[model samples]
Target: MIRIELDEAALGATRIAMSPLRDAFCAAHLQLPGRAPSWPYQEWAGHARAVWREDDRLRPLWELFTEGPPGVSDFLMPRPLGTPDVYEELDQLRATDPAFVRAQVAVCYPGMGEEPFLRPYLTDPQAACAALADAYAAWWEEAIAPCWPVMRRLVEDEVLLRARTFATEGVDALFGGLESRARWERPVLELTKYIDAEYAAGERRLVLVPLVFAEGCRLYSTDDPEVLAVSFQARGAAALRERTPGPADGGDRLGLLLGRGRAAVLRELAGPLTTAGLADRLGLAPSTVSEHLSLLAGAGVVTRHRVGRSVYYQLTDTGRSLLALLAGEGVLGTAAA
Candidate 1:
């Protein structure tokens, strides 16, 4: 069990951010020997395995990933500042300070820096950082980038749901509902892990990152006094591998009620998505998606929020109730009464 002590300030500083780099690393970690199967990303793992088998260039990266411990070094998987672009994260990895890299490598690997696979990182941290960045870029492009849109939506939805929980239900409820593997008791959040450890979150930030590939919770903290990052499995990960059922299929009652295209739009809004994202997913023009979104917004079935230059639309409570009723899950007794 690992116990992290959070003061009022630390608790107040807690926030959630999405990390593509962390997801990529977690995906690689999932491929390690003897790890339990992740059904949600099984198909993706098969393709990634084939790439790993055929590509000689990834061998170095693979060695580094598997060499030291059960987890990746915290330096390589820095806590994301916001919704990070993976390419920018690669650049950040490439530009990591040599001294900082060496310090973290020493802590993660301990006395094994002279080994053939680990020597480059300890001897020339800058070159090693660049090489690792190159390896990650190649792996990302080949294995993870194609499926990123769906994965991003899953994480965004998790964040939105948790944020609402924190806002309305207070911190205890928020942490209490995070996952079964974690237990919340006031200022201390206990995590189930293979080892016993303790951390005091003195004035640093605490970040909660949702991983599409995570099977359980993992905690990451560094000696450098940065943020403490906790990653947990996100909801609806199976959708990552499953095919999106076509809205026009005769079995979809929602399609019959709303036009097929509009119903498809509503279903996709289970997670927040931008207009262009919805268009690409549904194979419709952006103009058509915008018109559908406008009507849905006017009807109070969906709501839109502007984040920077992009507008994201998600289902309202009414929209969820409508879906539940159409799917035969909502109880009509209360309404009739």
Candidate 2:
């Protein structure tokens, strides 16, 4: 069991952040033998399977992720403020200290440090770091970037809900309710882990990260003596299913008010979707969806963000309120609810 003893000063220093690459890395763990299946990752697994067949560059990363690497990954997840970024962390990995990299290489593979991919770390640490960075980028482009919007939205929503929990139920209840294995007593929070150890938080802060794809809660201490990071599985994991729009009916207020085509576009925009994705879902041309999206943006109903070459659309607050009202009145059929 791991027990983190936080003093009164450390209690006030607690913070929360979300990581994109961390979730992607953890998703790799699900591909290993004896790992439990999760419903939220089914779509990701399907995509990853298809990508793995086409890309061989990611084999090293997949091999490393399939087994234990206890003290090896601490550098990839540094403690900081606000949302932790994947690209930023990858940059940090590129700049890791050579001595530390050498040490972690031994820790990562132990008896297998002579492996071909890990051999560069023993000879030229800089070259090894660069290769690792390239591998991460390749994996991200193939398996992560395509579905990051959905994962990001889920992580953000979970954080907002936890913040509400901390506000309404007090910090004690919030910590106590975090995971089944975590217990919050007066000055210490204990986690049931395989290895038993104790860490004292004298003055440094504790950073809590909510992860969408973590197998379970894990802890990491930073080079800075002032912060510790705890990554726990984000709530609502099983609910992240495919959100396809239902069959449209013209005998409704939403359809009559916005017209059938625009109404369907708005409904599917309940979650983030690219113009091409929406066109594919609704059986309309990309130009037709783009025209509808432009109109919706002009009317303050949808907001768009460019991810790579594609623009993803999601409902604004006004759009959500409109949908909520429609759903409440049974005008959107059963799918909206």
The TM-score leader among the candidates is 1
lDDT (Cα atoms) of all candidates against the true structure: 0.76, 0.68
User: Candidate 1: where are CA atoms >4 Å away?
Assistant: 35-37, 156-169, 201-203, 216-219, 242-299, 324-337
The residue-level lDDT of candidate 2 at 72 comes to 34
lDDT value, residue 309 of candidate 1 = 80
**TM per prediction:** 0.79, 0.66
**Tens digit of per-residue lDDT, candidate 2, span 133-165:** 677778788887776665665676556546655
| TM-score of model 1 (CA atoms) | 0.79
RMSD of 1: 4.4
Best by lDDT: 1
State in Å the error of residue 77, model 1: 1.7
The regions of model 2 sitting more than 4 angstroms off are 66-72, 76-81, 167-169, 216-226, 243-337
